[model samples]
Target: MAIYLVGDIQGCYDSLCVLLDMAAFNPQHDHLYVTGDLVARGPDSLATLRFMQELGEHGHTVLGNHDLHLLAVAKGIMRPKARDKIRAILDAPDREKLLQWLRHQPLLIHNETKNETASGFVITHAGIPPHWTVREAKQSARDVEAILHSDRYLWLLQNMYSDEPSMWSSSLEGIEYYRYTINAFTRMRFLTMSGNLDMACKLSPDKMSDENLVPWFAAKRRETIKETIIFGHWAALGGIFQNNFLGLDTGCVWGGSLTMVRWEDGQKFNLSCPV
Candidate 1:
């Protein structure tokens, strides 16, 4: 049984199907680890959610920022934007089931195996913060996941839309703590030299003029630097493969290609999006 880690699908179901076909994916045999952003921005979100839900145990996805936004919109905490394209999912007959499935998804997936020279990997929608170690990140994610799956989730979703507390601190508590953890796992991209999140800069490294803002993975003395992190959300980076960081968002919804990485051998597969 193979495990394929795929980039953000957004709502591009056709590209997802084509990429799976190219990979010869067998739902019954192979496992799919999705980098999240499963529904939004593209067409066919309902179909995409249905397909992923049907995959059951064979498929897993980390919750992305867009995915969280969907939950907020569904709960009337936020209004749907004109470009969201997720109305189909909210209006679908199986909306409850789909949202339930999405809510149950974690913000972080850590699989540490003994095979292939102690191979282990962590998957998140955006990326883990430089301040938290791999184990710490996982624990923080669990803390928030509990709230998300609990009865108080509606309150959390309603209050999760702020960028305050832009830095990590162990002393943080309450909804602010959870919000920071969520941002780290779902919206993080770059960090200031002092290890504080630089939320405003979304441009790629080459395009950015600020030298103080470093990619989260490139921060000095990052505790999780040794851990292999697989993440999406930075489509501008376009499938960056570094020593320990694997970026899989290739902008399929923006006329790029859908990309996936076979976990066993680290072999990559791609299917170009239609023009």
Candidate 2:
């Protein structure tokens, strides 16, 4: 009974299958915790979504920025970009079922195993904001999640895109608050030393020329610093392991390897993207 935490699949269904095979994954006995971007930008969005949905209780995914974008596009709130290869998913026979499953997925997942030796891990598409404690991050996720599942979900999908309120504030209210929370959990990668999100910086940490900007995990006074956090979204960082943070987005869709890690033993498995 192993638990595998996987990086961004991003619609690379064949790569996912290869990695699962290499890990000898048994859906009946093993569990998969995917760090989002389950669809878009790869060769097989429809197959990827279908496979994840079929996993049922054995698998679950945190919502990435691309996942949210899919919802928005499906709902006619946003148009698909030229680079987005999600039309197959939108046109699939089970498109509604797949999208519904994705919409219901959580923005944050806290896994506290019963085993005394297992360390608890929080999985999110992107890293949590430095100002948020684990509890606060969970609460913020719930706030947006509730809306995503509610009748007014279309409203959220329509209004969720924005870069304002770049810093966390307890007083943030309404759609502004939800947008900020969503960005932090899905699109955030770098932050200024002052704790404001550097939305424009998407390069790997070493490549960035801005001395004032730092990765979210490197921010000082982060409340979730004591807990282990597993996230994807930043493919530029590849498989970064720093302190209590583990980054698993190895850019599989961009010709890198698909990576997965077993939580109990910390053993990693990778499958190179097909040429």
Candidate 3:
């Protein structure tokens, strides 16, 4: 079966469908995996969420920062942003079921098989820290996933925002814990040249300095996973990157093209957003 790893959809539903058709995906046989951020920023978030929910059974996805925020705001756990365009999903007749599936999505997906290209794919929404062993990273993710999918998930989502450590830690608590985990899984872009999270840097390459910040995938310990890691959430960084990590976010909301990667050969493709 062909496995296609895609970038952040970001509510670009039509674009995603276009890419899927281009790939000629066979849902009954082939597989598709996404890097998350399935909703928000662009139009058609409701359609995007519903589509992903239908595929989540056969596809793999890690919860993106925006995806979590959608859940938070929907449940009144967090207030909706001024510019968010998620009302369709929130008011939908199937909103509860769709959001529940999204919230239950995992934070990481590792190809458990032993093959080279076909197996050993580690997919996440953002990127895991350089210090975390593969086992540790997966375990930490499991911890967060449990809460995100649990009966008390709304409680955690209600209080899930902070900027405490800005790095990985085995012992973190409260908002700090959820915050760091979320950042690592979503907002991570650059790391200090000396190997630390650089949370303040968000420029699109040109404005970044070589003194302290490096893209997380370029940092040390990226090879610890020993496989391909496909992810999105880094529109500024754009498509493809260091090691086996494939970045699929093409910033379709920012007037960029929507993108997807075919794992059978790691081929990338883009579809323009309809204006």
Candidate 4:
């Protein structure tokens, strides 16, 4: 069975279907790995949420920033943002079920089988920090995953944001600490050359400050994950760059296109949206 790693859906339900058909996806046989941002921005978040809930029963979804935000809004912990189009999902009958499913989703996934030793995988919604080893990154993710998979998840989600140490810290406090940690994993884009996060800027690296700001992947990091990583959420990164990691969120909600990648070979495909 082939595994098709899909990019951000962002509530473009019709485009998702078209892309799936184009991939010849057979959920009964092949697995679907989604990079998250399952809902928001587009017109059909309720449809996206339901469809993802169904697909996730048989597939895998790495939680994106949008997915987490949806949960926050659903729980009344936060309000809607400028680009969010999740009203339908918030009003849906099965909203609770969908949020529960999203909470249970992971932040990272990998398959370091005997397949491509040079490049296996380590999937997250956004890119990983350069300083953290693959093991370090996975462990941080696991910490949040535990909270997500636990009964105390509601507590964590309510306080999941911060301006903390500004770098990875082993001894963190409150759920807010963990929130910042997860945020970087799922929403990070620009990084200083020193490896600190530049969270304010949303422009591509080219348009950012010339100081030390660079794409997260551009860091001359110590290579721990010696495999190809696939992620989304930074639409500014565009799709499929540097021939190592894959950024699949081509901003379909902003008139970009939905994207998909063949897991084993890395072939690419997309479907355009009107935004």
Candidate 5:
């Protein structure tokens, strides 16, 4: 039974299937863990969500920013952007079922099975904030996930769109807590010199014009983390593998290849996007 970790599909169903086939994934036995952004921006948001739903126990995904936005749009909290391409999902007969499943997904996945280089791995839509240890991240994610999976979820989806409280604080509560948790888990990329989230910068590290900003993984950590961090929100990274960190959003919707990594042996598979 192999375990595979895939980058953002973003509705590129054909590319995802091809990449999985190239890796010879057998859903009957092998598990497929996605780094989120399962739908949006590509041609088949409806089909992509359906496929992931069908995967059932074989598939797992964290929630991406786009996934959260889809929920908000479906709930009439916001209108979909013209470029979103998620109308199919909103119009689907099983839209409620699909979005419910997505909403119930967590902001982080942690596996404790030991590997040679690290204790295990944790997957998030974006890289973990440098200020939190793995245990702290797990608790933070659970706190947000509890709200996301509860009746107050609409409130969470509505209030989750802000960019304030750029840094973590123990005293933060209510909307500040939820917003910061969502941003750090889904939209984070760079950190300012003072270790606050630089939410406005989406450029890759080398392309970043601000010398004071560094990728979240590069920022000084609150403590040394022993687990590998896997994330996929930064397509500009073009797939990064360094030390214990792996960034796998290769921009399949933007003409780059879809990517997958076999968790046991660390072998990677890529299929060029035909979308």
Candidate 6:
């Protein structure tokens, strides 16, 4: 069975279906792993949520920033923005089920299969921070996931909105630790020269005017990482294919192409989308 990794659907259900058909994905055999942002900014979020939910174990996803936002809105911690385009999901009768599934999703997924290459891959919403090794990132993700899946999840959803504590520290505690972990896994894009998250900039590296800021992937990474890092969330990246990192968000909802990569062979499939 083939394993496929697709970029953010962002509620572009039609485009996602067409792209998956082109890939000849078989839910019975082939598994589909999403880079997250399963809903938002496009049409038919309800349908997208339903389709992915029905895929059951065959479809796996890590939580994206938008996904978290939806949960927050469901909990009345936040209001839905017009551009978010998620009202249908919030209004659906199965809203609780969909939100529960999304709420329980992890922030990181490590797929290091023994049958494949020794070093498999790790998928997160954006990318892993350079400060943490893969093991540290995984553990940090579990910490937040535990909260998200527990009674304190409402507290987390209520308090996870800050951009502070931009730098990571082992001594970080309480909300700082949870917020930092969430930001690093989902919202990270650029890092200041001092290796702190630059939460404001979303421009591609070439168009970046700040010379002091580097794309997270361009920063010096921890030397212990051996597995490939796969991520989405930066539509401006277009699609980055480097030595050990792959970015698949091609901005399908913004008139770019929906993109997916076959994990076993690294073959890519794309479908052009309209604005």
lDDT of 3 by residue, 227-261 (tens): 77778888887677656777788788778888877
Show the lowest summed lDDT stretch of 10 residues, model 5.
111-120
Q: Model 3 clash pairs?
A: 193-212
lDDT of 4 at 255: 93
Q: List the residue pairs that clash in candidate 2.
A: none
- lDDT, candidate 1, 1-275, per-residue tens: 88899999989999999888988899999999999999888888889889999999999999999999999999899999878899888888889999999999999999876485437889999988877788898999999999999999998999898887888889999998999999888999999888887789889998999988899877765454566889999999988888889999999888888899888888889988864
What TM-score quantifies how close candidate 4 is to the native fold?
0.92
The stretch of ten residues in a row with the least summed lDDT in candidate 6 is 112-121
Task: Evaluate model 6: give its TM-score.
Answer: 0.98
What is the Cα-based lDDT of residue 201 in candidate 2?
86
What lDDT score goes with residue 159 in model 3? 67
> Model 4 — which ten-residue stretch has the worst lDDT?
111-120
lDDT string, candidate 2, 1-275, tens digits: 89999999999999999899999999998999999999888899889889988999999899999999999999888999888999988888889999999999999999866466568899999989888888899999999999999998999998888898898889999998999999999999999988898799889988999899999888876544566899999999988876789999999999998999988888899888964
Worst 10 residues of 3 by lDDT: 112-121
**Candidate 5 global Cα RMSD:** 1.2
Q: Residue-wise lDDT of candidate 6 within 118-156, one digit each (tens)?
A: 358999999999888988999999999999999999999
Predicted structure with the largest lDDT when compared to the true one? 6
TM-score of each: 0.97, 0.97, 0.92, 0.92, 0.97, 0.98
Local accuracy by lDDT, each model: 0.90, 0.91, 0.79, 0.80, 0.90, 0.93
lDDT by residue for model 5 (1-275), tens: 88899999999988888888888999999999999999889888898899888999999999999999999999999999777999888888898999889899999999888757435889999989988999899999999999988999989888887789998899999989889999999999998889888888778788878888988898878798878899999999999899889888999999988899998888999888964
lDDT score at residue 126, model 6, on the 0-100 scale: 96
